[model samples]
Target chain A: MEFSKPIKISRRHVLKMGVMGSAALSLGIFRSQLVKSKTGSAAGSVAAQKTEQIGFMYDQQKCVACRVCQAACKATNNWEEGTEWRRVLTSDKSKAYLSISCNHCEKPACVEVCPVGAYTKREKDGIVIHDAEKCIGCKYCMYACPYHAPQFSDDTGRISKCHFCYERQDNGEDPACVANCPTNALTYGKLAELREAQGGVDQLEGLPNPELTKPSWVIIPKKE
Target chain B: MHWHWMIIIYLFLGGLGAGAYLTSFAAEKGWLGRNSSLRRTGYFIAAPIVAIGTVLLVFDLGQGLTKPWLLIGLLANLSSVMTWGVYILAAFIIVGLLKGYFTLTNKSAPNILTLSGAVLALATGTYTGLLLAVIKAVPFWATWIMPVLFVASALSTGLSLTALLAPLVEKKSFCEGREGRAHILLIVVELIIVAAFVGIMISGVNGPVAKESVALVISGVYALVFWGYFIGLGLLFPLVVYIYRYQRSKVPVIQYVSESPSATSDLAANEQKGHHSYLTIVSDISVIIGGFALRALVILAAIPVWDGITIL
Candidate 1:
């Protein structure tokens, strides 16, 4: 068989191919930057529109170890026996009192690990909400929550947690626990404002590190 | 949070089923001289063992039996390890059952199906460990070694179980051959992995809670279950029996092959080397018990890094 003559390329053809490759690479880089900026701006706008996070503040110096907040929370949620959403933790070392409920953390592990999507962190106020209807009673959230906030109910076979008293807050009323605190040790407001204005710490001697979940809570540590 | 014995059983059985299927697959591939009995025994047991374990898992769920409809929601979150587990388990169980059926009917399972089943079996075995390892709350469980240890234990126990049952099913001994060697190797590897797993946690690299968990297993609350059941009975006892018997089996091979042996001696020799010998039975049983004890100890000894502010 006869072989075809060898193909030849001039300097112009080589230069044309190189130029075209460079142009294509530059366009690809430019397109990616454009897409990234568009998405970034969209995220920024969404972040700006999000409502301020509501947080709970506890003054350990003022608390008298009263179990009334726990009772009020039970009254508010009407939880069954053996279930307490708010707990009064006392430290024998410092003689301090800590009344803790759900911190409604920024990176809620319960929200991330629930196989059934039963837990959700609210966009409006950053309140971590538990939807009982959607719960599969797997108790995964119970293990996932660092705060031990999600309480399991044997009756309903579902989990419940502090919802920041969102219904009462919507109605411009304090949560039952905060409303009923005789010492006014428990308070609630915008998390950022509370942190700035109060200048208190997010963690105390007995609390889990705030970095785990960035809990929407501020505490006035007890004086030694 | 405490998981009941059902979870422990489920973890134990899941690994066993996967391990058995693997052993059977190896036998089918000519590991045991093309013994259809070994293959059939493994195939028959794998799927049903896993299925029973799965049923216990479902019933253990808070709403599993009362509100069975909620189980469909297990697939809702793809990022959740439990959701991935559901998928892996479902596929493994289906393939296992189909393989078992094919073996029973004396039909050849497709190579693709067989290969997929093997992959799924390994996944199922690994997934059992990964399930606990992902829980960062328990520092003792959240280790890279968790899955590796569980896989080794699964293979060891699964092979022991197949060895225990093969003679009854096939009326012959497979315990004196390469199967014995493989079983011993698996047990040795499992012992090393267990040591590493416990050593890593107790050495304080994982933190105080992890150390506390290890203490609970090694010398504290679950010490008996860990030391007596898992270490002595599950691992060491079986290791001793297999080693002794395997050596004996090797020494007598020449005598058994010679025609000079008397008929009475021949019966005694056959009985000694039989798969259903009292030593083999006891060793296999010990391995099986140890497997259960290991799972139980793992589940019971996990001390969470924190149990919330209320407990503190």
Candidate 2:
């Protein structure tokens, strides 16, 4: 009732707030987040059963970055010129390559951010998929994805990312990128088996920690 | 990057429109003032402003609409911010139009209806913040403080907008009252909260990305606009103007030594009051400008930290 009255600024209030802010900043709160960045990066969502969960294994030692997987993905998914869901992101001077897509993580950030529920992670196989019709092309998924996985098409105004070739997987075939790898660098299998084959490791020097979204992939570091 | 000028405009407009409803509710319920004109003016302005914001958001996301689904049958993504926004915006428009019509027809509405509208308005104000805050990968945006900051600014914008418009629309009862003081207070609150929001973000979670984003706005390419326009012109300038007006209003006038309580003296005093009331216009406009600049600059300066292709 008395809100119309003049507001008096309190010194004690200001001091308390100032102290709190200083403590938060001086404690290196931001830097602490970096140390905790990899906290849960090694594990998948616990609620989701690990049994028969679809996953991938990328043996960087065997990869040659031939551009064949890139071609195969474009041909299969029919991505336009200057668009390839499967990309060979390589280092300077042709050092090595890291191919990534919708990690199809157990906890997919893209699915959570899609306003219209356009992006979904399949319950059965744990494959993340994008629905063109449902999508408003908001591109929230682009920012939501750390991998830069979703590609926006100017023609359709919709984002299309790798669904990990769910259609092929449903037919008991490897995803295009895995199937067309020249040196047998890419492989697909059940999550448990892939992790066993990968020696149960998730961290790699160049790759982001899987704990962020618990990506269902196994990457074997190229032997130095 | 997707949160561009269009999104910023939408944010400003949405807050403006929703905030009007809140002010109206306060006026209608005798919170800010028992001025019925404040309520009527609020109802009148609410629908049209919100419509513009909602339309801009639709077009921005729809990519200028070749597809039919762009305008209709929005999904109820419970986890998504936009989903809540869609529903809230729709409710605000309906409530606003209905209230506007009721006020136009000179009919008093039930308290329940007005209260519901106010609640919807609050949601509308907060939803835009949540929309950005839910972006998990963008450390620059993923913060709980975002919604609080947005709501504060929205309320400030709403109060200022009401003060700004009351003079033009219903000058007799509303503009020359306690709303100016309230507007001044709200902007000051907004300024403090904005600083806190930045501090929280600067000290928030996520590694290099959040740090870079804070840096980007404070001292990076966005420094000029953020500091100069938003803080200087929008917050500080408006603050100075409004505080000066408030202080000036508090000091009793000498009546210009008329030595007689005549019609002309009364007229002179009224004329002075009118000019003082007009001062609200400057401060309100400053607040609105500051609000828009803040939203737009935040979006413009946001640098999404991409997970690097770190070659080892």
* DockQ scores of the candidates: 0.20, 0.21
List iRMS for all predictions.
Answer: 9.9, 12.1
TM-score of the B chain in each candidate versus the native B chain: 0.90, 0.87
Prediction 2 global C-alpha lDDT: 0.71
Off by over 4 Å in 2: A1-51, A198-200, A203-209, B34-37, B62-64, B70-73, B171-175, B253-278, B307-312
Worst ten in a row by lDDT for model 2 chain B: B260-269
Model 1 agreement with the true structure over A1-224: per-residue lDDT tens digits: 12122112323443665587456445534643564476467547676567578899999888998789988888889885556789998775667788998998887888778876667666668888877776777776666666788888888777788888888987999989999999989988999988985549998754566777788998888776
TM-scores of the models, in the order given = 0.84, 0.83
lDDT of each: 0.78, 0.71
> What digit string (tens of lDDT, one per residue) describes model 2 on residues A163-208?
8888887698888988888898887888877888744456566455
How many clashes in candidate 2?
2
Best by lDDT: 1
CAPRI-style docking class of model 2 based on DockQ: incorrect
Residue-by-residue lDDT tens digits, candidate 1, B112-134: 97889889989989999998887
Clashes of each: 0, 2
